[model samples]
Target: MKKIIVLCVAALSLPIAIAQEKITLTQAECRQMALAHSEDLQKADNAVMQAELDKDIAFAAYLPKLDATATGTYMFPDMDMMGAKLQMRGMYLAGISLTQPIYAGGQIRAGNRLSEIGKDCALENQRKARMQVIADADNAYWTYIAVLWKVRMLESYKAQMDTLFRQTESGVSAGMATENDLLRITAKKSEIHYQLQKAENGANLCRLALCNVLGCDLDTSIEPTDTVIKVSLPAELDTDISMRPELRLLHKQVEAAEQQVKMSRAEVLPTIGLSAGYMYFGNIKMKSEVGGQSFTQKIEDGNALVSVLVNIPLFHWGEGTQKIKKARLDLQNAQLDLQKNTR
Candidate 1:
């Protein structure tokens, strides 16, 4: 019977030990995992990737474009000379062409510049998301630690009150203290219990928030191996506004807008294009009749050509003027935003 009791006790202890062997996460480890797994960060990174793709697309416009084309045709009831009947003709042709843009009225340049600005903005937005995640994690970690400390303090207070209640009971029994004293201590103990409950709830909530930021299961247990360190802020501000990502992004926007204005003005100027192509024509048909003898022949010919195209915009109603005005206003607004963010 004693052996059976010992075996049961050992079985219970085995499960408890297994439960305690689960993995625990340190604060730094949690932060690193959050940086890699957080949904918000991933979205920000995707935005940056999209911006880069846009930049690539915009830059591609400056390069030459190549294309190939083919055509087939069939004709019935072919026309004849001197009111005589002729045979029908069928033909097939194929060609390749290339066009290079030497100039585009600054449109390509402005587009590339805008893409660069967009990329910068996307990067800054990513930085902001990262900072927000770090701040949130910090707040959650500190709050959790604070609540845990509060729980410990409440437990300590409860233990002292328990001892006091026992002493008061003993005193009352010996006719040295009144029952009211014991009742007061009991009331205090009840209040501490309520506080402990509240503290536990707060700690649980903090853990949930931390888990959410870390992109982990809500029920997963987290044990912060690192202790929270408190630091006092400096009395005087030493950080400069120019170093802030917000300010830098705004400045880049202003510069991009200025470039846009310049590009818009360039639209009024002439554009030049250098185009060259090699084309092949196959299966050409020609009708011929000599001494009442008719025949068909297949031929192929290749040709290379180079040309230059120049475009001068004399007038476009008020579209160009409107664009220039819009660009100027955008530059002004970007400047104002930069100023505001700096402040």
Candidate 2:
């Protein structure tokens, strides 16, 4: 009685121990799951975000920057000398500075253009990754379907073979069919049984691979609810390669390289900017130990000033020219890559 009870308990627990979600999926669902779980797709999304930040940074170069600073000092001794008392013990200093770029010899504009192109490239790459993932999932899904259907059809054929073998056995006994016929039937059944086993094994492996692609555990069994049907191909198809993402990315690369060349050329030209600042410092009378002016003041209280700045590049040891040449070469390479990929 105890053995019987234990057997019953084990049988009941078997399913519970290895149970998983019995998900039924169609081709679209499988592709969606793969895209949702793919690490490569997630990284492509991250690249787009980073490219947006790069564009923001490039645009910020033309905006003015305002800065403010303050400082405090403390001393043990406070000195009062002459009519002016040096407030050196408790001193405070503060200033504000502003900088605006009036001209950058086309460098800023070229950088901004390059950043825009880079953003587009990232977006196109993201789209390409999504398409690739979907296509891969679709292939795996359909392959699983074909293998499962093959296994099912072979199983039915085996059953028919079994029926034929039984009828032949009786025929041989009745002197209607030869023993050789029965033997051949038996051999054919064995061959089919072997083939059926191979097909079933292939089906199981296909199921596991599809489950992994769809973000399910390897142990989980997948049930595909979709079936393949015959479809007529279009009479004419467009094989144009202009819509490919790879070619688009290469084109963007060429445009960005052209901008880089412009920036490099700008490096040898003159740059102009505007600067304005306001500074203030507390006046303190020197102690008796130090005898001189009662207070330390330069520029008569250090008035505010605004000035225009210019930086002229006189010469470099062929550095700027070499960089421009290199940028042009990069552009040529990008164009060639686009043509190659199109081919």
Candidate 3:
């Protein structure tokens, strides 16, 4: 029975030991884990991919478009006109048309340019997100390590106080120390104990925060590989801010606004297109009887035609002009924003 009880206690303790297993990780590893776990970075990547697809879609506007059409009709009754009967049974028509844009007033080009700028903006956003995640990971990692050190320091201090309390008790028994001294040491030890408990709780909270950043189990103990930090000063300071992702994104936005202005201007300009189609028709017939002689006439053939189309926006109550002005204003706003951020 004792052996059974011992076996059951060991079985219960096994999972607890496994659950508290320490995981040792370096700062770099923690940052990498955080990067992998960051939803913002993933969203940034998706935005970049969507931008690329938009660029492709914009470029497709420059290519020719093809369309197919088919039609069929049937008549249920014949018609009589002046003693002559006209019979119609079935009619069918099929055609395929190709339309190519000769000119679109620079709208397609400007749209493509805008999509490219959008892609660049998404890339900059991704870079910014990556940097942010890494910074957060580093902060959490170092903060947890610091708190762990604090906990250890408090434990050590508690041990030293305990030793002092014992010595004081012995001295009081030997009459070398007063009871007041022992009481003073006991109160101090109690304070130290309270402080140690608080530090341990703080350390646990910090550990949980680091685990959250790392996307790991909170119950898993973490031991940082770095115990001491090495501080260094840069030999030279670099003040260039143009390469920053935020600044680059702003620049891209400005370029995109310029493209929007161009696109708006294009709305008022003339557009030209070329279209070609081939049509086939069959199963159409007219039956007629004259002088007791019957005859049937059927029309079944195929024909092709090409045409050029031109459009000029004469007027729309100054709508196009207003749009152009609005786009220009937006462009100005973007420029102002860029200037403000740069300053």
Winner by lDDT: 3
Model 2: weakest 10-residue lDDT segment is 293-302
Clashes of 2: 5
lDDT of each: 0.81, 0.86, 0.91
With candidate 2 superimposed using the best TM-score fit, by how many Å does residue 131's alpha carbon deviate from the native? 1.1
State every prediction's TM-score relative to the real structure: 0.84, 0.83, 0.90
For every model shown, the clashing-pair count is 0, 5, 0
Encode model 3's per-residue lDDT on 31-121: one tens digit a residue.
9899998899999999999999999999999999999999988776877756655555778899999999999899999999999889889
The runs of at least 3 residues in candidate 3 whose Cα sits more than 4 Å from the true structure, single-residue gaps closed, are 1-18, 75-90
Q: After superposition, how far is residue 317 of candidate 3 from its true place, in Å?
A: 2.6
User: Regarding lDDT, does 1 or 2 come out ahead?
Assistant: 2
Q: Which ten residues in a row have the lowest lDDT in candidate 3?
A: 81-90
lDDT of model 2, residue 74: 82
RMSD of 1: 4.3
Tens-place lDDT digits, model 1, residues 96-127: 77788887878889889889988988999899
Best by TM-score: 3
